[model samples]
Target: MASYASKQLLSIAIIFFCALGHLTSAQIVTLEVKEGNSTCIKAELVARFSVAYNTTNGTRTVTFPFPGNATVGNRSSCGGTELPPLLAASFGDGHALILRFSINGSQYRVESLALEYNLNDSSIFPNSSSPSLVTVKTDSAGILAQINTTYRCESSWPVSLGGGSGNASGNASVTFSNMRLQAYMLGSDLSRNETVCTADQSVTTVAPKTSPVTPAPVPTVPGNPERGNYNVTNNNGTICLMAYMGLQLNLTYPSSVQNKTVQEVVNLQPNQTKSSGSCEVSNATLQLRDDRTNLTFSFTLNTTSNKYHLSGISITATWPDMKEPFSASNGSLDYLRGTLGRSYLCSAEQTLVVDQTFAINTFHLQVQPFGVNGGQFEAAEECQLDEDNMLIPIIVGAALAGLVLIVLIAYLIGRKRSHAGYQTI
Candidate 1:
């Protein structure tokens, strides 16, 4: 009975020591932030870790609390909290124990922030079994902490076991990790109004072609030149003007030349007029040139509501040594009528000349540097029949003369025949 009691006491002692050893081996893992040398008050702290163990083995688990606050900018302000319940394992390894936390919103600048956590192990073991070695090292290979900020700061630590193991017993170990902190200042304003002006100016010259004119009979007027009489001269000249985008201008001509009255005509070339959409020229000015006229124009951009006012348009005609200036004018600016686009005015003068018979002459004018932006100029002269139909009157007179001659001849012949037939009656 005495031997059995001694043996039972020894067995009790062995069991108590084994349990104590296991308790000592279990470890509490922790992460901490160290303050760095910086005066700015801005920093962020982040921590990540994983816990793994065997499930089938005699492994047990425990729940632990994570740290929240860290020292920043010489003050304890920035902090984080555990998202989920902290878990540990003893014997069997199953799913990974993932720990993730972040610390921010601390306006104060700090040198660095620290992190700390606990990892515990509880597992049953066979008698005289070797102690299991468990390690709590940085999850990422050779990387413990990462600091990403405007300032160049970092964390430092070596990977190793948190605590020593006990023979067939459980233990709790504490692990330490740290990161350095740095801070910076930030700032931001609005914009003003302005105006601008632009212009496009150009000049061009033109020479026109002429066609032969058919002559028509002239009417007799005692005191005036034959109404429809015109003599063709070799002095035919022409000028051609073309404006792709169109243009606006004003022209004037002399009312009379050398005491002879003159006439002016305005006509659009046949099949040459073109328009697109609702675009058309309105309120246009047309006149005969007797004196100088001024021309002004306002150009508008198609894509935007912008206008450009241009003036000082001068036209001069040069023939050998003769140079004559013509007058031009422009319309008032219409801010509201932006779609009017372009307009034009053209005029010419004519005079009657008497040498032996009557001849009509026209004053020649040339537009110097005759074109503007996308604009062209053309001029030509040809002998054309007068508006009056003098050819019809001439034909009627000839027919009447032929008829009168035939009647006279017939009367003479009839008188002769009667005299011959009467004999001495």
Candidate 2:
């Protein structure tokens, strides 16, 4: 029948759009910034949100992402030609993510972020009558800090931001995941998409860069750090942490209740992931999940200094034959230390033992406080192991060159002595 054929077509359409990833979700909600008569920027943001709320027993967390075709209301505000433009993606009940822009002469940047959530919304937060509007602001984390550049990332990892130090009463934590962005432009149209990010890599930093002329290129870090950008801001909008790096987790557990131990490798990347994290001053936490395994990384600042280091790790995983979940955790650790404002980079693989059954590792990794020039990683620090590896070749070449010079000098001296002995002959 004709009715049956129409139903089949509808089902096919749903599957196809879902396959396109977050891009399809944002396609229905478009935000644009304009200047005078020309459209300056076009953006489609597919963001995932996780909010922790108070429950009678304890704190419970809920994660929700805007679905495809969920843009039914005035979800976007993009028609403006003011000196500093504004764009917003609103999800009803006063929940929204708002971006404020600032322009100077020929350049523009994302000046601030304002995120709002409703504590009274029964659907978002169950059995709560806290009737107060909530708004969190990030004062000046310049997201698109470039001159006429485009920012695009469709990888599954999505940039992770927020976490740590939440209000004591209202919510224990809040986090945002840019599940994926498709061909988003900032300040201008896409001129070959200047900035791109994937699960294994990113062009990161949350600070804005300003210049009268063209801005310089944001530094590039290569060699498999698997770096992804992250930002954390307090209620005042001051950036507390900025980080980028690749993360890999190693889990050792019994394949079954009585079987021998087996190891599983999980890569923390955006292209294949469902991840969450929060950046805060003095402490940072990152979580990355791939396949059936999930990892939580806890980093802390040393009491003597602001150097951040990995302090703990926890993992949860599922196996094919197991009826119950498997988990492992360790809280006391000191690894991957670095200064607060700068980055730590190393090309050689390094591992940290969390316990007898679990470990964490990374190679070519870089991380820093995400609030610097254009939110880019600041001057970097090299790990000792990687530095040692680099030193080997240089030391060998220098030693060889020194021996050759020594031999040549001795030969010349001997010839001179022989000439002296012969005198006028």
List the candidate 2 regions with Cα displacement exceeding 4 Å.
1-243, 257-259, 266-269, 321-323, 369-373
Q: List model 2 lDDT by residue over 1-425, tens digit each.
A: 33444454455556544554432233334555454555555665555555556656655666555544433234333434553456666676767666666655544555555556777777777855344556655432324323455544443221112222223222211222242121223434445434432221333444223222323322233334355655555456655555555666655555565465444555567566654667664667767677877778788875444556666778887758444677888776545656666777766555555554455556566766433455567888766555434544665576557556655665565566656666774
Write down the lDDT of every candidate, Cα atoms only. 0.24, 0.52
Stretches of candidate 1 exceeding 4 Å from the true structure: 1-400, 403-409, 412-420, 423-425
TM-score of each: 0.15, 0.43
Q: Candidate 2 lDDT (Cα, whole model)? A: 0.52
Q: Highest TM-score among the candidates is held by which one?
A: 2
Clashes of 1: 79
**Alpha carbon lDDT of residue 209, candidate 1?**
15
Please give the distance, in angstroms, between residue 118's alpha carbon in candidate 2 and its true position after superposition.
58
